[model samples]
Structures are given as C-alpha cells and as structure tokens.
Target chain A: MNLILLSPNDLLTDNRACIKNPRQLAHIKQVHGATVGDQLKVGLINGNLGIGLVTELNDTAIYLDVDLHQAPPRALPLTLVLGLPRPKMMRRILQTVATLGVKQLHLINSYRVEKSYWQTPFLEAENIREQLILGLEQGCDTHLPEVHLHKRFKPFVEDELPAIVADTRALVAHPYTETACPCQIEYSLTLAVGPEGGFIPYEIDLLEKCNFEAVQVGERIMRVETAVPYLLGRLF
Target chain B: MNLILLSPNDLLTDNRACIKNPRQLAHIKQVHGATVGDQLKVGLINGNLGIGLVTELNDTAIYLDVDLHQAPPRALPLTLVLGLPRPKMMRRILQTVATLGVKQLHLINSYRVEKSYWQTPFLEAENIREQLILGLEQGCDTHLPEVHLHKRFKPFVEDELPAIVADTRALVAHPYTETACPCQIEYSLTLAVGPEGGFIPYEIDLLEKCNFEAVQVGERIMRVETAVPYLLGRLF
Candidate 1:
C-alpha cells in the first residue's frame, strides 16, 4: 500500500492504532520498508489524507498515531461503461478505473461476453472491493467508485442507458469507427467499450441511438484491459 | 488464450498433433473451453498465424490438425525504458509491454526503487518468459519483445544510453515537466518512465544530457504500469 488507509470509524475511537493483520503488516514491512518513527502518508477510507507516525514495530505488527485533516481526492468526471472482459482482464480494468478515480463504472454484458465469465471468483464482492482499495491506495486517494453490473443488453439499452446518458457526453469506442477519441475532454463523459471482439452492429446502433458518438483509439484493436488505460489517458 | 501459439518444429510436422502438457491442456479446457472439432486461431511462435482444427479429445489432452500459412503481426516502432516497478506491478508491465509489441524494454534502477525489489522471484528468467508468453497469447501474436536490465544507473546512462538514443527519438515522462507528450509521431520513439515517486532531479538531468526530452501526460501522475499503456497509446 503506498498509503495506509484507515476508515473514519477507526479514527474516531483513538489517535493510536495497532495494525496486526498479516496483509497490512507485510505491506508495511516489505513494501514501505518502514522503520520506527518513520512518518508515512496515510488516508482515511472515504475520509481524508494525513501522516501516520510509526511508534512501534515488530516482525508481526506495527503501531501508528495518525493525524488527518486534508480533504479527500476529487472524483474524475468520467463514467466508464465497459463490456465485461475476460476474468483476468476484468481485474486489471477494475483496478485502473479505481486508480483513475472515475465516478461510476458500468460493467455490461455484450454479444461477445462469455457466459462463464460472470462466475469467476474475481467478481465476488469482497474480491472487487479489495482490488478497488488497492487502486485507491496506489493513487493516494480515498473515495471508492461505485460499480454496477448489467447482465442483459436489451434491458440496459432500452430501459437504463437513456437516463445515464441524459446529462452527459456519451462516447463509445469501436475499432472501425471514424472519429478519434478526444484528449482533455471538457465535459463529463460516459465512455463505452465493447468486449474482445467488440460491439456488434446491433449493439452499436443501440448506443448511437442513445447519443453515444463512436470513437476509435487506433487501427489496431487492443485488449479490453489495455484499452481502459488508453481511453482514460486520452479522455483525461 | 486468444491464439494458440506453437513452435516452428510443431508446425513442420503433419497436421494431426496432440497437446498433452498440463499447462496447455488446462488452458484449452479451462480458459478457451475448446472441444472436439473446434476451429481455433493458432500462431507459430515468432512466425505465422493459422487456423487449427481440433480433431480429437481425450481425458488428458486435445489433438489439433494445424494449417499454418499467414503473415506475422505488425511490429510496434517503439522502445520502453522503465524503472523497475514492484513485483505485482512488474507482472502486469511485462504482459502489457509484450502485448503492445514494443521492439525492446529496458528496466533501469532509480532512486525511489527499493533495493530489495531486485531480488523478486518474478525477475527469474523462467517467470519473465512465462509472462511474455501470456502477453503474446492475449495479443494474438507470437513474437516476444526483448527485455534488458540495467542495475547501475550512472554507467548505463553514460555508456549505453547515448548509443540507444542515436537513431531513435527518446522521451522521458516526468509529471512536473512543462512539455506535453507529443501525439501522432510518425517515426520510431523511445519512452522512459520513472519509479513510483518519479526520477530525482539529478537522474532527469542525466537523461536530458543523453538527448532524452522530458514530457508529462497530464496534471495527474500515473503509476508506472498505467503510464506504460498511456504513453504508448499517445505516441504510437
């Protein structure tokens, strides 16, 4: 963890806190290489950024006294609508979107999405939360982005997408599209990307009808995970 | 696996071949969900792409009758110089750089890089090769990018960097720099990124002395892994 994250509830009780969990301890010792009295940057989960002074250290645990007063990170004005990628790629996507501090994420089903992928262990609530937390820590931010899943395409397009696109600039990424994805977009954008094979004609029509202008990254098609960072870089 | 990669020797043999290794079998069954008579895209390692017809299936393995007769993937006209990231991020970086098909990679040492990171098991030859293979499989290409390691910064910068930058455009990504990273460059380019906290002023100076121009992605600093794809997307 680049920044040790503590929840607001944890900070309310006392200024002194002891970290005994194996994962956090390993991170403190191995990743941070913390020595006694080393002041480390810390953030409250959904709270503020501050410095945590290490008071005591051992092989298994460490103690810290935190001082938090800084404001939470500003949320990105982007909402990502992604076609559910393969399990491995999805994990990377989740982390990248979180690190970029996107305001909302919609994981939607598409023509190319494998039915089996939804069952992967990586989609479990706890697993998803852990990945988001890691992304937040790496970016030295605290607020977590909300994640939504859409298992049916028709319902999402016909029933839900209009409201989501109502007040936002919506863009969909397709390899064969003519317009290039813009850089430093001024308005809040809702960006949609397809699965590995990409959105079919019908899917594209649905999105276009909903006011999503089609955009292309390059002539070569990139994997969904790679495309997420690429799209974010261009838009942000 | 998007494509089943094979060796030249495997292609030279007759059409019918049985793949029985634990890894390949597990990948076929668990990842690809291949069955008898399935038509799958296959590629010759460092060579051509073709279609494979799965002719037989047994308890332990699957047999494919291959027809190899297609051109290799287009090469990316880019080289990456990255300060070594942590082990977990390193795995993603290896796969991502390989997937993007960069011509070469240089993992250099920097001030913020912990000394112990050099000792990671993921740096082992076998492990690195495995990640490269995974990247190739995901990208549907079989050519592996060459990876280089530079442990001592000063000597590498003074001795090796000049030669490397002789014929290629070199750009270093530092967040505080004034120049925006150029987009749509027509010629080959080399990208340099720093460790977590970024390159110290002295390190940036050495790179600048070597004809490396410093550039920034945006106002926000991105993690090394995220920056790789971001940089490539804009430059290439």
Candidate 2:
C-alpha cells in the first residue's frame, strides 16, 4: 500500500487514528517495516492526502497522528463504459481503473458477455469497495471512482448513455472501424469497450445511434485487461 | 487463442500441416469448436500470419490447409530493461510484452528485487516459451520477443547496458526527474524500470553516468506490469 488509507470509523479523535484492518496492518509492519515516529503517506477516503505520524506500532494496530491537507492528483476526464469482462478480470479491472484515477466506471452487459458474470461475488458492495480501496491506496488518492452496473444493454444505451455522452467525446473500441482512437483528449470522454468476441452488429448500431463513434485501437487483438490500460494511456 | 501458431515441424507439405501438440489440439477442439472446413487464423513461428483451412479434426490430431502471407504487426522500437518481478508476475509480463509487440526484453536484478525472483522456474526456457506462445496466439502475431536475464545488477549496468543503450534513447523511469516521458517517438529506445521500491540513489547515479536520462510517467506509482503498457502506450 503506497498510502495508509483511513475511514471515519478508524478515527480515535480528530487527529488520531488506528489502522485495525489486518491487510493494512501487515503491510505497514511487514512491507514498510514502519516504526513509531515514522511519517507515512496517509489519506482519508474522499478527503485529503497528507502525512501520518506513526505514534504507536504493535501487532494489533498502528496508531497515527494525522495531518491531512493535500488534494489528490487530478482525476482523468474520462468515463469508462466497459463490457462485463469475465469474473477473473473483474477484480484487476476494478483496481486498475481506480489506480489510474478513473472517477467513473460503468460495467455493462452485452450479447457476448456471459450471464454468469453478473452473479460474481466481486460485484458485492464490500468486495468492490475493497478492490477500489486497494486501487486508491496504490494511487495514493482519496476520491473513489463511482461504479455503475447495467445488466441490460438496450435500455441503458438508449435511455442512459446518451446523457453520459452529451458533453463528452463518445467512442467505442471496435476492430472494423476506420477511425483511429484519438490521443491525449483534454475534455470529458465516454469510451465503450466490448467483451472477448466484441459487441455484435446490432449492439454497434445501437451505440452509433446514441452518438458513440467506433474507433480502433490497432490491428492486433488484445484482452480487455491489456486494452483498458492501453486505451486509457493513449486517450488521456 | 486468436491464432493457432505453427512451427516448422508442423508442416507436412507446402500446403498442409498437422497440429500434434495436445495443448493446441485441446484448445482448437474445445475453445474454438472447430470442425473440417472451419477457417481459423494461423501464423507460423517467426514467419507470416494468415488463414488456415481446417481439413481434419479428431481426438488424435487436427490438420490444416495452410496459407501464409501477411507479416506480423510492427514491433515496438524498444529494448526494455526491467527489474525482474516476482515469479507470479514474470509469466504475465512475458506474455504481455510479446502481445504488445516488444522485440527485446531484459529482466535485470535491482536493489528491491527479491533474491528469490531469479530462482523462479518460470524463467526456464520451455516455461517462458509457453507463455510467449500464449501471448502470440492472443495477439495473432508470429515473432516472439527475445527475453534476456541479468542476475547481477552492477555488472549488467556497467559491462553490458551501455552497448544496449548506445544507439537508442537511453532512459530510466525515475519519479524524481523533472522531465515527463517523451511521446510518439519514432526512434529506437532503451528504457530501464526498477522494481517495487524503485532503484536506490546509487544505482540511479550509475545509470546517469552512463548517459541515461531519468523521466517520470506520473505521480501515481504503478506496478511494473501497469507501467510497461502505460509507458508503451504513451511513448509509441
């Protein structure tokens, strides 16, 4: 963990906090080998990032005298609308999106997305929160990315996605597209990426009707895991 | 597997080949559900990529009417010198580099690289080749990236790295640098990335002495896996 993240529940007072989670505790003790008086990077969720003076170190918990002031790094001016990748990739995607400072993520279903994916336990609030927190910790940021799931495709695209794309550059990653994905976009953008086999013809047509222009990354096919970072890096 | 990769021995004649490898056979039958007359994407190792006509399919083997013409996707004009990540990450890195069209990769030792990382069986030739083939299949590419290992840091930096960096834009990813990483460069590059905690000051000094300029990706610290794709996306 790059930053010691504190929730409101961890506060002993306005200035003092204790890390009780074993994950963070083990990381602080074993990975960091932190000692009392060590100044650590600490951030409050949706709050500020600053220094935490390690006041007490023990097996159970590490007490910190907190001073939070600095704002987190600027978030990406992008909203990712991705097909629900296989369950195995879900956790990593969550972490990656969070780490890259993506403020909004929408994992939606497509014709090619397996129905079993929606049933994954990783989608549970606490589990999703854990992955996002891990991602936030990695980025040393505090603002959590808002994740919205759309299990049905048509309604979400026809009713909801247009509004999301109204003020943003809307694009979809498709192999057959002649247009290349643009680089270093400075304004808000809503990008759609599909599942393993990609969005079907009907799905593509629907997206295009909603003002989402299809763009190709390259000639070579990439797994969603690789494609997400690749697209994010290129677009932002 | 997006492409069924073929080796020299797989060719039975100029126009025909049989896949005997159980791994590829199982994948072709199970994942692809291919039958006679199915046209599958196929590529020859270090050769060309094209379509293969499935001529025979059974439990014993699969036969293909081979046609090869198209060249593999252009490789990144980069020689990446990376600190050897832990064993679990090693396999994935090998796969990712190949998938991204990286031609040369050097896995080197560094201050923060655990001593045990170099001992991974995943570093073995057969094990590494398996991962590369999986990557090539995923990317529909023919050429496999060459992976080099450097068990000693100081010697590799002093004795060998100078020549590797001589004709390239020699760079080291260091967060302390003022220069942001250059983008859309068309020339050859040699980039060195340190392991988890990053290179110590002394090592950075040595790299600097060898004409390697330090460049920063961003403020958020990313895992080597994330950084490789991110930097590749930005630079190329």
**Could you list the CA RMSD of all candidates, in the order they appear?**
4.3, 1.2
lDDT of candidate 1 over B1-236, digit per residue (tens): 67777765554375655666577778888867888888888877787778889888787867788877887677788778889898878888898887778758899999988899999999888888888877887777778888898998889899998888888899999978789988767898888899988999999999999999999865444678788887777776
TM-score of each: 0.80, 0.98
Scored by TM-score, the top model is 2
lDDT of 1 by residue, A70-135 (tens): 886678788889898899776777877887788599999999999998889988888888888788
Off by over 4 Å in 2: none
Fraction of the native A-B contacts that model 2 recovers = 0.51
- What is the RMSD, in Å, between candidate 2 and the native fold over all Cα? 1.2
Highest DockQ: which candidate? 2
How good is the docking of model 2, by CAPRI class? medium
What's the lDDT for residue B219 in model 1? 45
Error of 2 at B130 (Å): 0.7
Chain A TM-score per model, please list them: 0.93, 0.98
- Residue B75 deviation, candidate 2, in Å? 1.3
lDDT score, candidate 1, position A72? 67
